[model samples]
Target: MRLERTRREPEAGMAVRTQLPAPPAWMRWLPALFVAALLLVEPFTPVDWPVSFALITVPLLAAFTQGPLGVAAVTVFAVLFEGVLAGTPCCAGRSVGYLWERHYVASYVCTILVGAIGTVLAAHRTRRERTLADVRFVAEIAQRVLLRPVPHRIGNLLLESLYLSAAAEARIGGDLYEAVPTSYGVRLLIGDVRGKGLLAVETAATLLGAFREAAHDEPDLPSLADRVEVSMGRRAMLLGGGEVGERFVTAVFAEIPTEGHLVRIVNCGHPPPLLIRSDEVSELDRGRSAPPLNLGVLVGEPYSVDVYDFRPGDQLLLYTDGITETRDPHGVFYPLLERLRSWGPLPPRELLEQLHGDLMAYSHNGLQDDIAALTACLLADQPAEPAPPSDGAGGSSGAP
Candidate 1:
């Protein structure tokens, strides 16, 4: 078996898209229209009721939709409008100064103060939004580096994976998965760190890095698991800082041979994988299970590898606890096995797509934990036929 370690880079110079939609044309002219209407009515209204107080709405609206400079311009217009209205002829043919009584002066002062405060608020909001955008971009890059995309096809098996972070705004969390084609077979790892945030992310990165390197050097599943445990222990020592209850990771590792009908798995305090056949779905539970990595010191015995049949037309699903532990509004846990029974046999991609949609619908789109799922379909042992080479012109390249 040969290992394919390929990294795909994103297209260069992609632009960031803004989430807030552009303000409507009518909204852009709303402040001007409002001020004009107030001016037209000022001659008819009584001078005792200062109309300038209503002018504050212009800057208030601008604060929500426009930048600081735009809000400042609106504030200046409001103050000028109030001053002009005070001097204009009004009730009983009174002079402009007649409108500037004690109450009128107080109202005029309040309007100017309110507009200034609105401009400052708009500036502060814009700065906060920009900072959030920058942080989100960094989090996305970190997620991509830690959990590289799994290829659609690995060796003879078709693969599919899905990851959903509970923190929708951040778009990333501690859940992780990696599939590597090793000399022994195609080894896979799906794991979840015990906690959330950066600490969990660091532990997940440490686990995946160790798995990718050790999968090739270790002779068997048990030894490979040992390597990961050792790596996690070292990482915990650096991260724990003498804390008593440090973080740990629960994982399920599996190996599918190049030309075999058996799959070997090691369950390290993680949920058991589901084996789906023609008309049956069963959990691949073992008699013995080991403690999660970084907590191996608590166990007296070594990890046990469980073997199960993974024949043609069969699909195996590996997932983190987030899937089974999800609860609906009524506190009902998700019925993974019951739901899979109706899906019948499907391609890895379609199966995951349907499952993800159903899961969201079941939870009303409010999942409390980060979820990671990997599905592997065992294709025929014989190699697939190669397609004909394409002519140089932009013709069809044939089926993949």
Candidate 2:
């Protein structure tokens, strides 16, 4: 597998296209079609019955799909066409000079008034759409920076991640994950902040930043967790309020050492990671737990790391509670463990893809909360990479 960075072309150098979303071709031409239909039937209709009066609806139709300028142009055309239909001798059996009649003139004035109103509505609609587009653009950029993609392969491990926000338009949320190659091992972190909104985003960012830095410096998983805890505590202190104090992040940290079949994990008030081996799946519960980040002082529990044998073909799955908590129409929670046991073994990416599809189907696309999951598999029979040479002090150091 290969890691690829996607680069977007600079918008400054690109030509500006109409900001309005594309609708059907027939819909955009509906106003013109309405005018044509009126002209065709006007000649056949009686003098007492005038079909051209319906031209007032032309501008309204255009306003739905066209910009202000387009709507105004259509409005003007409709008024002029109404006059033509009124004056044509064959149309509605009217005389040539009927265009200047009091009723025809009234029809022209009313069409103009309606057109003006439609133009104003179109302008307001366009502005609101543009503002929404800008907001979504900014949100997308933030997501890329905060939840950067994990490298497909780190050491002998293959990794994949999936994230979904409960909100329809939201691209990022409190759920977060990251993987980094450290001198100690291939360290991975996945976690979820307690609540939603800006505060939750801030908390997730702080924890990810702390993990990235501490993963390289801290040699053991417990020390790494401690460093992260200290960072979270400092951040909570800076916020300085009771609401901020209520904020806590549930996380699991895993380290696959440079040369070993054993994997170490430190779970802190988070769901246990899944161990998938062949046809059997089991939870990697450490039997005891550490308090979540920001809750160390309140829970006052010391952190501990659990070691488990991770064979070459075994896969590890880390996720937040959102996955299992998703409910169907019957209010039954999704059975993730049971489903995994029934499925055949697949690659990390394909496995997550299937899981994502199943979750969406289970919830009928009505997700109640943010979801995040990361899966990593040890490549079968691949030899571990050689560790970097140690310095004179007997400590190994190199780029992660």
Candidate 3:
């Protein structure tokens, strides 16, 4: 007769809490110290079963609280303690022969085996931990090098820039801004690439690479924009896409002339940049509407750039739609125009910081997308000349 067997449910493992419970510093050290003490007493006295059992606690504690480093250290402490406590002098008439050959050989082997396993386990754990740390370090380096910190000054333009990448897990969606002085004027670009991750980064890089080159040669913003579109189209062909099929980049380029009072602003399906004055803020509206760069379906001519009157003491704030499109829980969007209205009279950097802080506080420190802000404030007047060429002399410019 065959007997029926019953199936049993597997026991659930303990759930790791998001918040790590940090034990007291002294208390954390206690178990390892205790193991060290036992190892010290292990060999001098007759080998006790209790002592080997006690060794288990050190590693278990280290494994939980101190991690791999602590485990390895505890193992070393055990080895040294064992060597000092138990190893006999291999000298004639000093019990060396008896101790080495007969009296404690089996016990010594058993004691060593347990400690050796702990040490090896600890070492393996340490190596694995180090590998993880190295991976994280490399990722952080890539992010730093890829998204370099844009200096506060680009060519003749005094820039105050702010960039905030969403949480690390989000992999940073593409929101890009750059200011470079060309033969034409101080050319500034603010763009948000279609989609995210590697694809978005590739599109952003392609657009900027083309812009930087074209901005110097194209002279007109439309030509530069066309160049960007062509470059983006080429990349989409090479990379193939889900986002490229459904998404497109919105961009705005500004060319600020040193001698002129007017600044050319090109809005290529991009959100209009806000102009902040002493009392009010207004969007730099476009006269001719156009599609975003790299729609691919239709290749169009260059759109005309709008000229804006920017007097001294005026500030231009350029940003991606992330700032304006951020929705609160109540379906209310953050109004950049209104915020700038109340938060004007602030210097460029300070104003951007204030906006950043308010956004964070309002969103409970959670951002769903990348944010890039570029503020250029026109100074009332050029103040004074530098003493000489000491370093990169910039003691005379910027707005108050």
Candidate 4:
């Protein structure tokens, strides 16, 4: 894979992203070579080179950083060096008695055997690490494909999204949002799984997977909501006793009709999404909502849907609390909607960037939690382009 050098960044760029060049291969093998050299200098298998305290230091440090492969390489080099120098006339063959002595030969030979076992152990661990990396990479790629970039347009609305995980190493976390055009309307979902790591991500994946399936099958937003809850309940029941592990997500699901006429909203204990239209910004009416999904908690018959008329150019902003909950220098809560109302009518990408900048500034370049933003705007319809000239000479005389 090709690696790109980072020259500039929107905000703080971690220095680790620009690590120095790796140490030379010979340097990697130096410890092994040095161990082999000990047989000649000590004439004993377990020769204690006070300097070889590096044996523990080097392998552990190398293993911690470069891992088992690096340690294995060093081990191999040591074995090869020992083999070349082993039993090679320590006294210049002055006599057969001295040359054939068991003490002289077997010491290095047994040392070689021990070194061989060590190499085998190190190599095995190295292979396991490579396998883990491959698996993690595949999982990472799957997360990206499943949650591809939010489309620029959804139905009659223009869509923009902002997403950032807590790490450069991970592409996803417990936070997810998606907007898609379906027969029912343009459907959108913004959700946050309970935790901060892989298990939480797995829960989110479960929700999205279930949503995709049920979205197509269920007739209305309420029915679709029930289907999701049912799926989560089934998952919980699968693990023996009853309810699953402690997990929950606050979410908002909305549907915008094809011509941007009506917007349907359903809340599931998630952070209230902001509706910005005509210079007014406020959290959509919460009224009374059920507990988040997967907690074995749900309520209401129809799970009431809040419907609003969405005109062209109106915007819907979906976000996790990470942005709103961000604390400032004196620990005052960030005022997200107030600031958003102040900076009215920003396009989706600019809206996200501006909010991200504000969050960074509020925290003074430190964020205690992850931030994800998805914005959808209903744009006025576009006129179709006129049909092309029938003979290519309508605008200008033939060739002139």
lDDT to native, each model: 0.81, 0.85, 0.67, 0.66
Candidate with top lDDT is 2
lDDT of model 4 at position 392: 58
- Report the lDDT tens digits of candidate 3 across residue range 67-153: 555666765565444444345442212343233433345544554565556556656666665665565455444444444445566
lDDT-wise, the better of 3 and 4 is 3
> lDDT tens digits, residues 124-154, model 2?
8788878866776677677777888777888
Candidate 1: how many backbone clashes?
0
The candidate with the higher lDDT, 1 or 3, is 1
Evaluate residue 154 in candidate 2 and report its C-alpha lDDT on the 0 to 100 scale. 86
lDDT agreement of model 2 with the native: 0.85
Error of 3 at 296 (Å): 6.4
Task: Supply the global lDDT for candidate 3.
Answer: 0.67
TM-scores for every candidate against the unseen true structure:
0.78, 0.83, 0.66, 0.62
TM-score order of candidates, top first: 2, 1, 3, 4
Worst 10 residues of 2 by lDDT: 1-10
Q: Which stretches of candidate 2 lie over 4 Å from their true place?
A: 1-51, 88-101, 383-400
The runs of at least 3 residues in candidate 4 whose Cα sits more than 4 Å from the true structure, single-residue gaps closed, are: 1-139, 240-245, 295-300, 384-400
